[model samples]
Target chain A: MPRPAKKPRKSYHHGDLRNALLTAAREVLEERGPSFLGLREISRRVGVSAPSAYHHFPSRDAIALGLAEQGAAELATCLAAAPANPSGSLLTYGEAYIAFVRANPALYRLMFGEGFPAVSQHSAAIRALRERSYDIMKAGLEQRLPASELPIAGLFLWALVHGLGLLLVDRQIVRDGDLEDIIRRVLTLAGTGLLHGRGRDDGQSGPPPPPPGTRSA
Target chain B: MPRPAKKPRKSYHHGDLRNALLTAAREVLEERGPSFLGLREISRRVGVSAPSAYHHFPSRDAIALGLAEQGAAELATCLAAAPANPSGSLLTYGEAYIAFVRANPALYRLMFGEGFPAVSQHSAAIRALRERSYDIMKAGLEQRLPASELPIAGLFLWALVHGLGLLLVDRQIVRDGDLEDIIRRVLTLAGTGLLHGRGRDDGQSGPPPPPPGTRSA
Candidate 1:
């Protein structure tokens, strides 16, 4: 049979321990990378005996995944609550993404790490949450661009925001640099098509183009 | 006065301790975040006595800075070597950013981390490297956009590549997604107009009303 539940072995009070472990894991992550972090390290910080800590987390990976799940849910919430209009979403998405990364660096790293939750199967809630952010972009792309250009526009917008988020979080790009200004300007540029006076492109006017690389990695 | 230089207490062959520290620091970075990393930990891993490391690196921050410098230099090289064409630079820049992050994530983190090399005050070399990438987009923008619009174009292109890099490195977006196609399509959309082909925006036609937060962010 699959391993029995680890929590509530001695008593039903697993909630406190769960939060404590997550707190400790965040500490470890701040101090170091996710790889060097061990459950025992967390247990030590939590003031609990090592094996006893297992009551909350069956294994180290489980704890990490738990954190990642929480992050994805949170990120989804962040993007979901963005301003109502696509234009507004365009302006605030970068700010929200950057703020999320700054507030929860470790959790953010976990959410987007090598073990990033897979889209094909693994978790339905996460996939939906992640896709919702994409949906915002999709709506924008659908409304703003042609159907044929969906794939590239989607990825492009995603990449621009994603990279800027990382830069903001890691402090490579400083907050004092006026990021909001930078992001809005970029979006406007992306949205405008170099030719602004003549607006409303329906795709037939420009040259036909193929999709991006087959293998992105 | 600044602390006196530590003696070259070890072998006089001038065998580089700097590079050794970098490798060890890389290991530490992969294992943790910035604040908690220590020279002691790295020196221990390098099999060098802790104090000896001070001869080369005055402190762990110095080590972190070195890593950041190295990463930026490498990134500059990659961008510099890329062909001048917007499409080529787009593809090359995308691959370069992803490759740097994937191959040396620790260094990549250091490259953008807090208290490290501040990007806004970039060294002349780093500044030019950044500007060169921006220039590619500027050139594209110049064809149809006003010089005033270059800054916005720069940020957009940078954002797209930066976001793609992080997503690919973190595996949040997709390791093998269609990145090249994404770049071209993104460029095409931004270059010609919105992907929607809804308007002609070439700056020369007229400076129609600029979008409100366009310059602010």
Candidate 2:
């Protein structure tokens, strides 16, 4: 049942090395999470020398940024492809966003600057792609929400999908039933408020009951 | 401006070593993040032999779990202390939750099993603590949403806050104005639906506008 070890390639032609290294890096990112991403390990996986790998990525952080850019582009594509919701609700967009995150959990985290802090700061391409994804959500909102409400509304929807995707990917949600059902229900709530009130001034007032297992800080 | 180097502790009595090692581990976690966390590094930071540190923690993962437990407990205390909203709104709880994450960014990540995979799988106390936090959110929703709606409602609110807190902590949100005001606006949107509909049957329908710069996958 043991697999044969990979034979090292003597050399990769011009652009092939870069793609090969990135492919190996993606495998590492998925298998071990971002913490294990290293230029040395990636090059080793690609059956290349450290110097050869260095030709493509100057540092581990650079490789992470590369993955981030790749993830961002793919994510934007997925969002754009989601069937445009006709009901002015962001449900379809949310579904697409979470679907991307679920499929590429580690890559999604890396794109968001999870392990490599510099990825968020150094990559203009990544930022632009992120903005593109946001624009998809914003396009949905522009049709339904007032001009004044777009910014906060976009962020709210973004946070909702982002958080839900993470929790689902992290296995934080306790699944008692179909996950798709849970997602639809939660997204539905976002479209229709959790409470009866339609604005901030809704006069529903009462102290929240004490949480169980209260402990002193 | 250089500080004095820590001297090796000659020895420690019974329970003190555990706390001391944990304190040093926490410093490492905040300074270098979870990926940098290791038994050897922690012992070196504490100026203790590896064997001595191992007496308290079996492995690097055990130490990470210890930190997770500490973080979960602290988060629970913070949430429980948030002034209960009298108007059945969870804004106060959401604020408290985010404030804790902002204050302890790395620790918050660790508690949520960011770098350490086994921490989530192994810790019962951490799971219970997380449930307690969810219970706080659920308690707030119980006052407003019907029983059939509680599960999705609780998850929706949790995802909203969890996503919002992470976005804020990760610096994913561009700050054009007061962050506090932005958070309030977003949480307010959660209370009142983003759209005018009260349920899933709202009839507004139209093909969403094509996202800008749509790229083929």
Candidate 3:
């Protein structure tokens, strides 16, 4: 038999180098963060000429823009894939949002972080994707909340999930042993009307919490 | 009388030049954005030499870093000024956060927008200020929530306000007419735990509103 051909030296093209670049970019973003990422470094890691990487992404910001688009797509998936038995699809979308942010902290960061401003301003594809995602969110809300409440509901849920994502990604909400527990606790507080309906002192707006250095009742 | 006129433009040494440069830098950052921001521009705006701007901020990124710090300081002040009435504190914080973002969209954008990193790593003063703000949220929660839940509460509420800030600043949560109405609704939802705890189900995360194509029972 002919000598076994040595495995093709990992093909220079990486088969799908456009996607390959995104994956590599995300890795760098997550590991070293955006500040340390370099297009040449991505090319070197993929064993391609630095210029070759440009064919896939015109510039570093382009790479960042692509990643942000991916984030919107993934977020859409998260919203679509939430539990089926919920009272409102909007609620499920919100939970999925928090989950997606928690699961892919770096990618989520790219979706909203400052280094990717062009993603919001220039990319039609990315903008359309996010717009569609928000539309999905709005539709998801009609299941339980009134039509008038949709905008407010959408905003509140969006803020809670996005905020939680930032905290988890930045390590601001760390709990060594009971990580999920605290998240669930927060989720309960956010998704339910437990806090507001109860203790309604005519509910115009409840009083502020007691000031610091003051005794609790 | 003619000789007495011109005030010498208030000759500023290095120390004073620092503040002047920072103020000028922020003016440019708000007007021109990051890509167009430059030393020559800042110096021209401040009536100083291009080299003088360098004495304060070594590079454009350094100016950005300083602006971001200033933005963080402003954020702390805004959050601190929210009302202290227990029933309204949490809710008012959300509304106040929205208002600040609305009033200073570009500067707020610079504070948290892409390419701009959190000030925690760049300036000790900013970091301390940011921490103090977080403490306000944390302390507020401790007064209303169980001790075990305080940290999560702080994270959740801060995320609510900050996330709301970003969304509102970006017009993602549009504030067309009677904008305050939408804001108050969101604050109500957040304070009453509607966003975090609506359906009595915490096993799954929340959802965005359902889109046109989506069907729910």
Candidate 4:
């Protein structure tokens, strides 16, 4: 998926160098993965001087944050397009989420990976984008569950989808045969486990005691 | 909590130098966080020369792999000890998982964080440790779930707890009052959702179309 560098043109017209830089940086990130991203390299691709690039992005982290902001927005769009029926919406949302991650593995990694700060620590704009994405899921959940359940339920749903997405990206599991079918079955297992407490009747078996001579670290 | 470095002893004793270096490395990782781990510093703490240190861990990635392996073993131990009653075992395992993360945030991060290779790419030992940890959860899930449902069911459970643990680590969610009680409630939501499809009946409201003028990347 190599993207050829755009031909450099005269600087006679300075049209949104900031956006041009972001687009170029994102292309580099997706093509080379997060580790290869360099502000100078990205600037060079966009035919901008280092000083001009610095004016918009002060550091590598700033550029990462910009990419993450874009990623979150894209994620929100994907989530928003999920089917709205309460019965199928969660599954649709889950499917859409996995699809997005599959399409943009590196960008998805940057959004949640150690390369960026945690959600709580992200810059204001990035944080808002993340929250907005979560809100789409929450609003979908709101139609079926009690208001009291929304917060933790939202967290659980987010974790389920996020974890599966990571596992897929790591190649821990493959989306075999039909992609949506796999998502549907996995989501059904999780969603049902949450709704009915399916294992409630199974007898309890306490974990075996630690082997003798074991010492806590 | 600070672990004072052992008094560097005479070079006359080379007893268990490998284990000694690993122990020191773990102490450093837990104390200063993963970012502070350096082979020379660890070897120095253990009264070893730089070349001696290199003998055990050729590079920092090797040391990280070692730490991750240790963390996986520790996590496996925690998972193995949960009360085994089929009815409550999943919840108990979930609680233990979160508690382990809360107790050793940095080590937990090291085990699951960006430092190590992907699961598919990990060396044999690291991958084995990871699978061993997951198998403990699967064993618990087995007692209650049909054999047909075990695989995906186990994944959902792992994702649920892992996601919650990460959210707690990131400070995206807080554990208020009794810790286990909160975990119990969150698990109930996800597990029950899977069992009953509680959100099944809500009307289908199609997700709104993407906002105008937005272009896909």
Best candidate per DockQ, number?
2
Return the TM-score for each candidate structure. 0.62, 0.84, 0.73, 0.79
DockQ-better candidate, 1 vs 3? 3
| lDDT for B94 (candidate 4) | 78
Residue A36 local lDDT, model 3: 62
In model 2, the clashing pairs are: A86-B205, A86-B206, A205-B87, A206-B86
Best first by DockQ, ranked = 2, 4, 3, 1
Rank order by lDDT, top first?
A: 2, 4, 3, 1
What is the per-residue lDDT of model 2 for residues A138-178, given as tens digits with 9 covering 90 to 100? Answer: 77766554444567778988999999988987888887899
CA RMSD of all predictions: 9.1, 9.1, 10.2, 9.8
Clashes of each: 41, 4, 52, 29
Q: Largest lDDT belongs to which candidate?
A: 2
**Candidate 1, position A86, lDDT:** 57
Tens digits of lDDT, candidate 4, B152-174: 66777787787777767666664
By TM-score rank, best first, the candidates go 2, 4, 3, 1
lDDT of each: 0.57, 0.74, 0.64, 0.69
lDDT of 4: 0.69
User: Which residues of candidate 4, in runs, are more than 4 Å off?
Assistant: A1-17, A38-53, A117-120, A174-179, A194-216, B1-6, B9-17, B31-52, B118-120, B174-179, B193-217
- Chain A, model 2: TM: 0.82
CAPRI verdict (incorrect, acceptable, medium, high) for model 2: acceptable
Per-residue lDDT over B38-68 for candidate 1, one digit per residue giving the tens place of the 0 to 100 score: 7788877766778887888766667776666
**Candidate 2 at A117: error in angstroms?**
3.2
What is the docking quality class of candidate 4?
acceptable
